[model samples]
Target: MSTTRHYINLTNSLFPLPGYAADGYARIKGISALVTTFGVGELSAINAIAGAYSEYVPVVHIVGTPSTLSQADGMLLHHTLGNGDFNVFSNMFRHVSCVVSMLNDPHEAATLIDNAIRECYVKSRPVYLTLPIDMVQQKVEGERLRTPIDLSFPLNEQEKENYVVDVVLKYLHVAKNPVIVVDACAIRHRVLDEVHQLAETSGSPTFVTPMGKGAVNETLPNYGGVYAGDGSRASVRDRVESSDLVLSIGSIKSDFNTAGFTYRISQLSTIDFHSTYVRVKYSEYPSVRMNGVLRKIIARMGRLNIGAGFKPNNTLPAVEPESSAQTITHAWFWPRMSQWLRPKDIVITETGTANFGIWETLFPADVTAISQVLWGSIGYATGACQGAALAAKELGINRTILFTGDGSFQLTAQELSTMIRHELKPIVFVICNDGYTIERYIHGMDAAYNDIQIWKYKDLVAVFGGVEDKTARTFQVRSKTEVEALFSDKEFSAAPFLQLVELYMPKEDAPLALKLTAEANTRNNAKA
Candidate 1:
């Protein structure tokens, strides 16, 4: 009955890639409802659901199960544990999801469904719901449907919030040099307006973590740069590290986000705001939530203003020429590709080379850049591109651009078929380097284990049901000159159809940041 109601919104997939589907839904900030058959189908997507949980993307995994009678009779059906324990999958889901529900009674179905969905939005994490085959035709009362499930924000203690704000004010007022650093939680928690308000009102140099790149506007006058600890540009590192006070919002201090814990900041001068708490030096305010606290601080901006002695010099220095000769390099491609993007374009970058290389490019305002820096999952961006494109379509936006390496693309490239099926127009740029450049940089630079079987990437469009000059088109370019012409070309840039650009680069070339971090990671791995 539920499927019948939303049949128009439904699209069947070739596999149970809940990971890809969940990752895709995460990009658009939408709730995913993935239907899978019991055991075989459900387990296929369990790993993806776990990824979604780690990244705070909400997805409802609905499982169609065997008959209730089979469970009662202890019948060892296909796709079961053979011991008649059908609860194993449900038990596993409890670890990854914030909520789990099963429809056993028609009278309880409506409330369970509502409550599970409410938790999904409130927590912003995946949920698991199970439906026995026998419950498929059950009817439930609609009386409670009028009252919407309460998904309102939980309030922190007003007194505690005020106390934290005053402490933050004291630090802000005395600091000669102040800066604002944003992280992933700022994007997920929906307090970006508050982050922007604080930065604008404070007139501080603002920078984003690797995960928080597109959350805040980077074109502002006081914008410092991307702050990835030692991996940051020299000027940005100097300004941020040398600051008298650092106000970090939604900060996730992961190894990747912090460039292998390379950040050097005095905790005494740092005020950290998170989704549910705030930390000032050694003192932790447990109930002081960022959403309410940030909103309150923005409201009191006039009184909290700390004028004079705090000025940020935002200058963008150009890197040296990527190629003295006419060769396509990582440094060269990303910077040039920057100008090719338009406003409101959703850009998804895969892990490894694309993830690291994209940091060099300065994104324009209103252009969203999506990448799994913290997850560091290869092949995620392709599936995420599918999600972003569909989300853009629903939101009436154009252009879903994706940048993925050859190794990662090969992992989940089947998602392109889904995009073609749904008629989503995304311009996919597959970085065709020979092997895993990131793995090579980390351990064995010349190991055969780092290599992959190369496929004719350009021919995929035809195999995936993409018609030339109609729903899809493919391009393979090998040189700087050809890439320059394609990016500069008005028609190609528009990409009115689902387009693929197989970009061939040097087998060993990697982003400068990746090379540095790979060495650090190697040392860390050696220690472990």
Candidate 2:
């Protein structure tokens, strides 16, 4: 039985809907559902769904099409492009989704639904289903409803897993300095427990890529900082690159994730543990998976000799040098965020400056950070915040926070009204730079195209129907002193209601990581 929450009648666009589903999946670590009309609506949402596909988020996308009889008769549909083809939209979605099912037969509807959902869960990607209006009420099997769909991943063959583990141990045991690098797939595959056990048992210095920011417990003594090639802090870069053995867990080496493919670690010294395979040096074991292999490796940790007397460096780069200018710079703001965040909070960052800036922010324990680093849609964080907030509310989490640049927030600002309608109490901090800061760093430093029309960002809550002093509140802070006071406030920290903070920062200043990445991006684009 599905319980209907109040309908969100004021959705501005379909672009943010997939962000909601993707972030909901992130929070719950399960599949999320999205419903759209047949043609026009699904096309508008395809970009974000493709983003979910790129980042490995499992979202079940259901489309409501015309009746089966209408599609069969080739009737002209209102949402169609004045054509008789009904499968045009589904055909487009095939490139982005794991499974695209059209429920035309009542006998196979249940099996199709079950298979679609199971594949979505197992693959950690979106699946599309077209349910005609006529088939909504069709009864297939009540017996199938009694048995829940099995959502387990296939276990690796024990013999192959053992061989892979032995090969891994051979490298791990001999290396004087072995470090673990956890990436986004570790979180998507639900293997953080195995990751944590391996890190703890081996006592190795563990680092995360930019996409893997919150995968490990940052408060742990063995935790190193974010490692993104030249974008990383000098200490972290040297530590990771100088290691004798690298155990990369669920790594996704995208251009942005690795600072434009700037990783210095060699494949010969790295053993990669993936969802479906294990690569030890140059040899690949196709059937061996990470979760089981990690478990077996942990069982034999007594034979490992690495990670002894390896002091971990988790400190932020010096902040006072850049923060002393009275205005809140990216350098100061991100590191200061480390002090403001609480344990178990859900933090969503936009793809612009906030995405790279967050690399410097050290999270408290069990914090979940959501960002589209690979897909990198500009306004994705605002919509994702809504879904993450809804999931957090359902899970009884106290706080959900969003960090977005002013330019990106404008693209999906209408989602704020949805947040108000749902009465979700999330703290939103809009970096009120005058333009697209990340783009400026990448290419157009002085171009007019980079500038934006600055709005009264703090007034958005009131414009979105949030009652002042009750369901919502707003603040504008410029100086470091003002930001410090705001962060120190007990009531504000508790997040009793929806709060918006218009944080003003220098337009040209960006995080160290973004600057390094943009330089690499510039160099790459200039290459022949």
Candidate 3:
């Protein structure tokens, strides 16, 4: 509602900037805004905008266009089509965005802008607005800017909410073993506190999907591991599938999220809590949203039967005491990284190996994990890292870390320079595995299409306008010992300046979840 000017880091490409806005919104818990020029600039960033819409991040896209007189006169603007139609680009955004507003009229511009942003927040999707050149200078009422937009959701009807809560309680009271499965929308809709209270108060085994990595506190006693049907660890999968009731919160059952539609839980045994509705065993209650319903359920629930519900097995698989001389593998790297992560650190993972590999990581309390699991956009994490770092800096949260693959990093590597210009310090790990490992798993294991040119990734800091020892530093860790040594280094761990590590792993190596998901995808593709 209220706008403030933050530091804008200009980048070479428009593609990654919207990604920055997406994660910035996540970190700051508010709608993030980005501006683009008409047609070309807006079109270039549409992919990222669609990714935001897919992943439920609220972003406001303001586009600068030609003056209204020019449009009225049918003058062909350089960025527009030859036919002089300026609405074409905005039309394309309608499919992805929840709201699109064109500010051709100066009188209604303020109201349109406010309503657009409100819709963006309420729906947790992107909104598109266009401002022409002459309209930009027109005097609008400053009185409206004094009051902030009302971003609160409409209150659920009291009778319907109580009835829904009562029905949910009935299920809870009679159920012997009920488990909670948190997913991506729980984070997107800002319902973590309600989710945490429900999980802790109910004492049910709580698990996260791959997309819901950091939705709940992992250190809790009832914290089960990530559940993605067949892709899950055997103990976790069996525990969830055998449960009498499953409370699925804010779930997005995408292909990768559900391990290619392999979820075994039946609708009869499941209750779904979404942003706008709540479902209990086959019956759904519309206009009964999750935030209030969860809060009411926790309040009304006096006791839970929870008979013989298995305790969460949070123990990481034991590995042989690794030496610095040993080669770094996914099995060793992921579990070790869990130990390295600090509380409240913001960890951003790329859609390649890091996204799937992160399922093994048991995050400490308040750690924020950001990734595009549903959208599955490559090279998004790097640009998101910049925006997250900026938001982190503003909020006084230290240590924004990024884990990206070599191939994916190359797509938006220029954003690193933007971080350098803004003097934001983040620990970046570029997993140099030679090619697109995820693609290799699904299709060709050794095909030419999967290969990428090798770059000295460590040299990128200097190439991107970063000073060697003052503003930035770089390192290459080839073995487990090297990784351990770097992690143990006080200077590196302190994250005083921008740091990039070329983390070398085998080209053919992949996380367990990725392998399982790839196999499922392959089989599904062969079906029809």
Candidate 4:
């Protein structure tokens, strides 16, 4: 057996090497199932690492911490050095990770690490393993070193097969108006083939949750548009709510994505295949293990005499094409966008008017919409665009396009530095309204705080150290003709280009998002 040594020389030594290497490792591998003591101060790096591995990538994160002695002694920390240190980092990751464990004994480290990896890979979620600094130097007796365990395929095979067959049969036999809601899990599980097969064989209309926007090639004929609050196509929403069976494969009912639990589908009739549990809400379906279940369902579906639904009636309202704007309307901006897009374009939308408006008005099967729905973080669009663009580049796909409100762009515009540094050219379409249109409309807050300091967006790209000729470029468009000309231009399609198309959207344009925001504010104000 080949053996290797990890010598931990100093207290701070571990931090710089393993800790630094861990981030790089995760970025390269695109996942983290291990946890480290690195906290919020390390967030930008951690998020950058996590973002690098995001969307179905399994990462094993292991965080190292000060020993129990340091914690008990209450040592002031450099990285938010703290008393009760373990809990501090644990809490920080709780929201973002699938599972977390703090390792107290060096002997159990191997087992814990194995378990974390197994869970992360199986669930396709970020898992964390925290090692106390004291454990780092502990020696394992050569004889006592355990055999490396492979926790891969933890699910019982026969049982998993049976479960998959059963679900498939259920879908084939029972539900009319069946729809499949794809989420990030579908991609992580590498189940795109299965999803396409199910969609094709079942001939069921498929709608992607916001996170699952590109789960299936949006170009498919059966592709129903995205289903989110006001963004949902009315027919798709009706079909989802009214369906006899809603197959929510890898979909999470997180608050942000669901518009605060607005959809009316009873959890009972829903068949949820998650990373951990297989839940059938209607029959009080006993939650079972996930793996073989899906396989079995596919097998059973092959034999079932289920009738295919009629060719999907594309009876949905035509998204009113943005008539070439004699003047700017949210409606006009999207159609111009739709006209510009080719198949396989990646479009990232920030949260607010841009998300609510542009996403609803235009339907580009090729566009990949990226947003932090669970967090609803405003500035996330820009950072997420960076990640999406990097993902596109790594996959050798189309250059990404980003739509950020003038307000939202300012929050993480610094990420433009990272974009330029990486030589990722994304067309940043900035809707230059003067204020936070969503907030102003929602709260009826004519508040001055909602108004932001404006910057000439096209000029800022150069200020952010973007290369003039090869790396980035910018544009400001006031009228529809200008927008259309940019869309039709073949030369702008090339990489390492940043086109900042500036549009003077009226504060009144995003009525729906504004209205929802106002109602939410009223309720919040009432609660206060």
Choose the strongest candidate by lDDT.
Answer: 3
lDDT values for all models: 0.79, 0.85, 0.86, 0.61
TM-score of 4: 0.76
With a 3 Å backbone cut-off (N, CA, C), the pairs that clash in candidate 2 are none
Q: Tens-digit lDDT track for model 3 on 101-211? A: 989987898999889978888888889889888998898777998887888877899999999999998988888889999999998887899999998999888999998
Name the TM-score of candidate 1.
Answer: 0.93
Clashes of 2: 0
What does candidate 2's lDDT look like per residue over 1-528, in tens digits? 132221112122456565454545444546677777778778878887898888888888888899999998999879897789988889999999999999988999999998998898788888999989899999898788777778778898888888888898888889888999999999888899999998888888899999998999988888888999999988789989999899999999998999988999999999999998999889998977799999989998774655443444324446564445788888787887898899999998999899999998888898999988999988888988888887788778989999999999998888899889889999999999998999999889899999999899889899999999899989999998999899999999999999999999999989989999999988999999
Q: By summed lDDT, which 10 consecutive residues of candidate 4 come out lowest?
A: 1-10
Candidate 3 residues lying further than 4 Å off, grouped into runs, are 1-13, 18-21, 24-28, 307-316, 322-325
Off by over 4 Å in 4: 1-40, 43-87, 90-118, 129-153, 156-164, 167-171, 188-190, 229-231, 267-269, 285-291, 302-324, 361-367, 511-528
Candidate with better lDDT, 2 vs 4:
2
TM-score-superior candidate, 1 or 3: 3
What order do candidates take by TM-score, descending?
A: 3, 2, 1, 4
Off by over 4 Å in 1: 1-18, 303-324
Return the TM-score for each candidate structure.
0.93, 0.96, 0.96, 0.76
* Winner by TM-score: 3
* Residue 277, model 3: Cα distance from true site in angstroms: 1.1
lDDT winner between candidates 1 and 3: 3
